[model samples]
Target: MERWKINLIVLWLGQFMVMSGMTMIIPFLPLYIQEMGIHDPHEVAVWAGLIFAANFVSSFIFQPIWGGLADRFGRKVMLLRSGFGMAFVMMFMGMAATPLHLLLLRLANGVISGFMPAAVALVSANTPRERMGFAMGTLQSGSVAGTILGPLFGGVLAEWVGFRPIFYITGGLLFAASVLAAFLVKEKFDIEQAKTRPKMSVFSGFRELIRIRQLPALYSVTFLIQFSILSSMPLIPLFVQELHGSGQLLAFYAGLVGSVTGFSNMIASPLLGRLGDRLGSQRILAIALIGTGLAFIPQAFVTNIWQLLASRFLLGVFMGGLLPSVQTLIRQYTPSGMESRAYSFNTSALALGNMLGPVIGGAVSGLIGIRGIFMTAAVLLLLNALWVRLSLFPRNQVQKTGS
Candidate 1:
């Protein structure tokens, strides 16, 4: 492999490991709350929802701050801070004796969680423009794969070594990633460009981020993409329960489904990104939204756990392309010096979706059932597809860089 390919692989691996570890906390949180003596479903649900949303709430608030800092200071610095910070928080979470403690730790972790965004900034800055889409896609696959595998392993580890051990394992993995990143990752800002880069105030930069004309559509699309994806997540465990799977087997099934989806995402993301580079991010985004909508629509009727898992895997195949394409589009829309704020805005939108998705999922699931949740997500996605088609597709407006 070439030198750049080698760097890409290492970077991608580090990101994957980091994401996998972070996500491990997701699948087992409620169970841990139960073990700590909270038995009321409503209480467990509330605490769990708070803990889950806490990270996003913090991250959403801090994402742009971190992004601008990365631009001014360095991407690697932010990546190291995020990786190490998350590791410490995860370890602290494992040691928590109360829901409140866990919630606090999660909130702090979210405030500092900028590793993936930093990595994207690094890739955007380092990779050639022509290959940037592919690089971003590869990086995104790591995140998707992490989400898939983290839950899978989290469920199994929680069952075997118990929830506390899973936390230790996740924290250890993140720390290890930090160590790797510390040694291997290098920043390469253009010194000449750096010197000439205008010093935009934080408020002005944020104003610019929000005021960018095409960005709202991009941000809206990101929110809907994440919303549609997560709308199905919190209920997957419940769906497994309806399949007559025991709790022990349910954990394994969760991992199995996660692994399958991760595999599909891993396989498809880079190819799709490469395609986006050739065809246009708008084209890829439109196709992905439509495919995801169709895939999600059938999941509501899944007859068994296997069928449900299969639908998830199929959905992953389409959804895997969406993030990188969005990243590429954001880069295309913003000027070179403004990349950090643009990415920060994108990250914030996704974090907002993360924070909102589960609360809505829980409420809607309570009112209409899990099946209805899937249908609701499908309708939302379909609406997004139409909106993109009617509005965003017209200009063929995959803007070129610095436009």
Candidate 2:
């Protein structure tokens, strides 16, 4: 493989391992807090929400800053910094004695958690334009797979040893990613440009968010795509419980469904990316939306765990095409030298989706049960698909030739 390809593969692999470690902690969190003698379910729930949101809050605050730094400094150096910073935080989190300490560490982790963006930047910077979507899709698949494995592994480790041991193991994996990143990656920071360019400003970054013309459409797809894809999250554990499974079995099924989705995404995203390359990202995105919207319909009617898992697997296959296509479309619309800012805007939209998706899904699921959430998400997706098809993809010829 070429050097860039090699580097991307290494970065993707490291991402997978690191995310696997981090994701493993989520499912086992309630159990860990209970083990710590926080017997009050209300307090445990509050802590859980705090723990979940802490990282995102910090991440949302820091991503634009990191992205700007990456633009000036170099994508590789930032990647290494992110890996090392996360490693340190995860190690510290492993050793935390209190929920406050853990929450603090999670916040710290978020501040430094730009590894995915760094990796994406690297791919975007080095890959040829024709292959950008495919490469990004392939890269995304690795991280998604990690989301599947992390929790499952964490659950097993938590059961076998304890929650603390799971953290230790997770930290170790992050440390390994740091080491690999430090050695394998290389970049040439633009010292000349840094010196000549006006002082970097968050204001300028925010300006870029406003300057892009098609951004509203891009962000619209972003919100709907995330809302569609993630609406299943809060209800997964409940779904497992309703099936009358043990906690361990619940963890296993959670892993199974997650693993299936991520695994299928891994298998399918690159193909979609390639398809986008051959056709156009707009076309691929439209088709992906339709497929994803249609896929959710079956999820509402699943009678068994196997059926649910299969539905999710199919959902992943359709959803896999979305991010790569979105990223590519955004890149096409953005001016040169603005990749980082553009990406930060995209990340902001995604974070907004993340913040709202679970709450909305949880609320709907509570009111009408899990089935209702699926139906609502599906309808939203279908509407989103129709909008994109009419407004975006059909104008592809005008877009591609820069009329």
Clashing pairs in 2: 24-150, 24-151
Local distance difference test, each candidate: 0.80, 0.78
Model 2 per-residue lDDT tens digits across residues 1-403:
6767877788888779767866778878877777767879999999888887788778877888888887777777778888878877887876777788888988898888788777877778778888888887888788777877777788678879887877767777777877877787665456577656665587776776656546667777878877766766778777767764665677768657656777887889889998999998988888888898888898788878888888889988988898888888877877655666667667767766877788787777768787888888889988887666655654675467456
TM-scores for the candidates: 0.86, 0.89
Could you say which candidate leads in lDDT? 1
> Number of clashing pairs, model 2?
2
lDDT of candidate 1 over 1-403, digit per residue (tens) = 6545655776788788877876777778888999889999999999997887788899998988888877877777888898888888888888899999999998898898888778888778777788877988889888887877777788778778988987888788888878887787666866566556777776788787767666777787889877866766777777777774675677778657646766887889999999988988888988988888888877788888778778888988898777888888788778767777788878889988887787788778878887888788888877877666655554544344215
RMSD of each: 4.1, 3.3
Model 2, C-alpha of 73: deviation from truth (Å):
1.7
Name the lDDT value of residue 169 in candidate 2. 70
